[model samples]
Target chain A: EAGVAQSPRYKIIEKRQSVAFWCNPISGHATLYWYQQILGQGPKLLIQFQNNGVVDDSQLPKDRFSAERLKGVDSTLKIQPAKLEDSAVYLCASSSQGMTEAFFGQGTRLTVV
Target chain B: DQQVKQNSPSLSVQEGRISILNCDYTNSMFDYFLWYKKYPAEGPTFLISISSIKDKNEDGRFTVFLNKSAKHLSLHIVPSQPGDSAVYFCAAIWSNDYKLSFGAGTTVTVRA
Candidate 1:
């Protein structure tokens, strides 16, 4: 079976610029998630979507970050006016309902200069 | 506040020896705990998990032990191999929520 897929394995943007990342979840998966992994840190959940409806987004920066999952299959995460601190790897994961384990994508490493 | 913490930033052990990584959580509501292993430039892969109702879970060479009363958990890898060197992260989730909260990862190095 194919795993979760993400595009633009690497991205570099200047401060104040905007960047977007995309994710395609595994087939038949009902839950999708976006996570950020800063250097030397574990992945932190930025948002979660349960079938195109957001389940949680408490950690996302509302002023600069936004995400959407259309049709519950693909999702996108955007950051506007990117800051140096925004440099990190953006990971996407998916899991089936009532499943405890999640499958992750390779992630897009974003570098904000 | 950080709900999960891996106090050890790095650990080294000889090949064929046991490697133990520790993690602690501050939230009692967390009922499911997991361990993920990650290599450089790759996403974390789920290793093992234990529920609050159980104290230990074992899978092949990997084992996870949970101390619910102390809010602590640990992962043990026996007969560690060179390929086992990677960053290990501990994560937890509340029973009602599917989202996971992760700790800072611990880098493990196995020497031959």
Candidate 2:
């Protein structure tokens, strides 16, 4: 079975610039999540979607970050006016409904200078 | 606030020895706990998990123990191998929202 897929494994941008990351979840998965892992820290939940509808996004930076899952299969996370602290590995994961464990992608490493 | 915490930043053990990593959580609502392993430049992979209903769950050489009263959980790896060298993270989720909360992580190294 294919695991979650994410494009642009690495990205470099300047502070105040905008950047976007994309992810394709496993087939038939109904739940998708985006997480951010800063250096020496664990992945922190940024947002979650349940079939095109947002389930949770309390930790998301409303002013600078946004994400959407179109048609409930693929997702895109965007950050505008990126800051130096925003530099981190953005990971995408997915799981079937009612399942506890999730499958994760290799992740996109973003570097904001 | 960070709910789950792995206080030990790093641990080193001899090959074939035992490795124990600890985690503590602040949220009582969190009923499910999980462990994930990550290599440099790679995303975390699910390792093992334990539910609130049970005190212990074992998977092959890996075992997880949960103490509800203390809100603490631990992972034990017996006969650790060199391949087990990586950063280990502890995560928690409350059934209500299913949002995962994670700790900073504990780096483990196994020497040959």
Candidate 3:
């Protein structure tokens, strides 16, 4: 079985510039998630989608970050006016069900200059 | 508030020894706990998991022990191999929620 897939394993952008990361989860998986992992810290949940509907996004910074999973198969996360503090690895994961083990993709490491 | 905590940032053990990593969580609502191993430049992969009702669960050389009363859990790797040297993260989730709360990982190095 194939694992979760993400694009542009690495990215760099200047401060205040906009950047976007894409993710394609495992086939047949209904639950998708986005997380941010800063250096020396664990992955922090940014948002969660259950079949194209948001399950939770309380931690998401609406002022700068946004994500969507349309059609429930693929998702995208975007950050506008990126800040230096936003430099981190953005991970995408999917699970067969809400309570199952999640499989993660090789994250997109964003470096804001 | 940090819901999950992994106190040890790093650990080094000689090959063939046992490597123990600890984690504590403040949320009692979490019913499912999991361990994930990650290599540099790679995303974390699920290693093992245990439910709240079970005190222990084992898979191959990896074992997960849960102490509900203490809100503590641990992962044990026996006969640690160089390949086992990596960052290990502990995560938890409530049955009703799809989101997972993760602990700052513990990096384990097995010296040959």
Candidate 4:
């Protein structure tokens, strides 16, 4: 079975610029998630979508970050006015409904200079 | 606040020795625990997991032990292999929620 897929394995943007990351979840998976992993830290939940509707986004920094899962199969995470602190790996994960374990993608390494 | 904690930033062990990584969580609401392994430039992959109803779960050469009262969990890799050298993260989920809370992670280096 194919795993979750993400685009632009690496990205570099200047501070205050806008950047977007894309993700395509495993086929038939209904739950999708976006996470941020800073250096030396675990992946922190940014947002979760269960069939195109948000399940949780309490940890998301709404002021600068936004994400959407259109049609519940693919997702996009965007950051506007990116700051140096936004430099990190953006990971996309997905799991089938009623499952606890999630499958991950290679992730996009974003560096905001 | 960081609810889940993996105090040991790194561990090194002989190739044939056992490797134990520890994790603790302050949230009593967490009911399910999991371990994920990650290589450089790759996203984390699920390794093993344990539910609150059980104290231990084993898969192949990997084992997960959970101590509910202590709110602590551990992962054991038997006869560690060179390929086992990677960052291991502990994650938890609470009742009625699917969002996972993760620990900082432990980097294990298995030496040949």
lDDT of 3 at A15: 100
Candidate number with the higher DockQ (1 or 3): 3
Per-residue alpha-carbon lDDT of candidate 4 for residues A1-113, written as tens digits (9 for 90 to 100): 99999999999999999999999999999989999999999999999999999999999999999999999999999999899999999999998887888899999999999
User: Across residues A3-110, which tens digit of lDDT does each residue of candidate 3 receive?
Assistant: 899999999999999999999999999999999999999999999999999999999999999999989999999999899999999999999885558999999999
**Candidate 4 lDDT over residue span B18-90, tens digit each:** 9999999999888899999999989999999999999999999999999999999999999899999999999
Off by over 4 Å in 2: none
- All candidates: DockQ: 0.81, 0.76, 0.84, 0.79
Clashing pairs for predicted structure model 1, backbone only: none
Candidate 4 pairs with clashing backbones: none
Which digits, one per residue and each the tens of the lDDT, describe model 1 over residues B1-112? 7999999999999999999999999999998999999999889999999999999999999999999989999999998999999999999988587888999999999999
Worst window of 10 by summed lDDT in candidate 3 chain A: A94-103
- How would you encode candidate 3's per-residue C-alpha lDDT over B58-110 as one tens digit per residue? 99999999999999999999989999999999999998976789999999999
Q: How would the candidate models be sorted by DockQ, starting from the highest?
A: 3, 1, 4, 2
RMSD of each: 0.7, 0.8, 0.7, 0.8
